[model samples]
Target: MKKLLIMAALIFAAHFAYAQSENIEEIQQFIISDVRYNKADVTPIYLDAKAYISLYRVKDEETIYMANVWPAKRSQSYGYIYDLKQTSVDATDDTYKNETLTFKWSYKNDFDNKQGTATIKLGLVYKPTGIAFLMTMITEDLNVTEFKGYVSGSLNLK
Candidate 1:
């Protein structure tokens, strides 16, 4: 009976170790795509432009970052920054009380199902009670065709 108990303990420990995934690291440049608001079409917009941009972890377990956008900063196409024309946040302390982030992008095709690609930043804010990542994305796409939507993808956390 003692041998049986010891064997069971060893097995349980091994299984527990395998059940946990690796901890996510401080990513420098993470990219994601497939940002849609509806589930109409599954085609990728900005097929030529890579999304997800770069990321920075200010608080390790919780962080946000951006890099690599469609129209770089000088192209007059698209760009991102800690500050922009749309820093509409309710932040009273001055640091964007976490309102709307400049991480905004969109695509739509009313004539023939406009596909959109948006790269919104995600932040994992560590609070006192628990850890959570929060980020916002703006979507004002009017669905005219079969599927008008928005979607976002993130890097594999582990």
Candidate 2:
């Protein structure tokens, strides 16, 4: 009877562990459609460019990737991957209905080697028939950029 009870407990523990890991495997990608640059001159320029970004959150480790989508002549379009210093997620039970997530990080580009703090906010919403997603990035002493688009999971932006 003792051996049988131990075996049953082990089985239950394994099942619970598997359920927890499934949530952590989710990765979301965002395609930037329009970029609004808020210049220091109080004039904002809107550029309709093709860019890609991704976010992956797992406990103390979160990654943000900004893809370089210019020139169209580079060997690789994948840009820098920054380690986020702070992250916050405010989500509802139905994430597609309404949700918001924010990420903060400091980065230094290889071009000028200047450090700056970057904060990105992701707004997600769901309509009766479709979904809507928007992302905005703000940096210190730099232009604030806004991206209007949706993700591949529910909405398509072209």
Candidate 3:
């Protein structure tokens, strides 16, 4: 009787662990598509070009956030793996039924022997049919040749 009870408990624990892992996989697969940069400029020059950015939630001791931005022209790309400090969603005052998702992310990057810490604010709006996103980055060690206007684009969930 004792062995049977222990076996049942172990089976139940395994099932629960599997279910939690599946949920994490679903969250990791969430994708944002059709993103383009409308305005921006960071050194290496090509970083300013329009691009598509994808976000990923990596499973670590704590969840690790990461993003990959590939230029629309396919010339250059940037990778950001960081900690997502906070996120908030709220209804927007637009006629077209939309909600805004805002995220505050922080990361460290290295460029030409110089390392810098970056704080990025990403705002995404879910439109009636599609989505739109805007991002701004502030860095301590990277030079921004052109940082006027804004980085704006459209996003589609994949």
Candidate 4:
């Protein structure tokens, strides 16, 4: 009886493993380093865990749009990823108050134990314009934060 019960439990666990999500879960585990920007140079914003920049802009000096990344699908390719959406933000300045990007996430990856961040982060210089790029870097422990959005909207997988 004990052997049969153990086998059953193993089968149940295997079922769950096989039932794993076919899509890369969108998790809220990204972070950004608060920095001061001007209408001139691109800022050195920190990537959360995938060598990625949460947000950046050359002229705004405030607010960043972080690209929430994930695998394109259940593929074995190492470069199959997608930018679900972006979280719009307003950087804190003496001229204005800092606004948090309203994000809605439903995935989780406790990646804080290792060092991973997004690379080659870029954005518009002043919204709906030229591309402002930021060379992304990584050097911290953080969770994989999915979901990016702005004050009046949200980014997610439907």
Question: How high is each candidate's TM-score?
Answer: 0.26, 0.50, 0.42, 0.22
Model 4 lDDT tens row, 51-153: 3323322242343333333223211112212243443445344323222222222222333322233332223222222123322222134322222222112
Q: Rank the candidates by lDDT, best first.
A: 2, 3, 1, 4
Model with the higher TM-score, candidate 1 or 2? 2
> Clash number for every model?
18, 0, 0, 27
On the 0 to 100 scale, the lDDT of residue 124 in model 2 is 72
User: Comparing candidate 1 with candidate 3, which one achieves the higher TM-score?
Assistant: 3
Error of 2 at 147 (Å): 0.9
lDDT of each: 0.39, 0.55, 0.44, 0.31
Candidate 2 overall lDDT versus native: 0.55
Q: Pick the candidate with the highest lDDT.
A: 2
Instruction: Name the weakest run of 10 consecutive residues (lDDT summed) in model 4.
Output: 73-82
Per residue, candidate 2 scores C-alpha lDDT tens digits across 59-146 of 4445444433332331113333454333334456664456666766555554455666777677777654445677677877756877
In terms of TM-score, which candidate is stronger, 2 or 3? 2
Model 4 alpha-carbon drift over 4 Å, by segment: 27-100, 103-158
Runs of candidate 3 with Cα error greater than 4 angstroms are: 1-50, 71-89, 92-114, 142-158
Error of 4 at 145 (Å): 14
Q: Model 1: per-residue lDDT, tens digit, 1-158?
A: 99999999999988775553233333543233334435443336433443334443334445343333443221112222333234333435434333333454433333345445454544442223332333344444443212111223322245
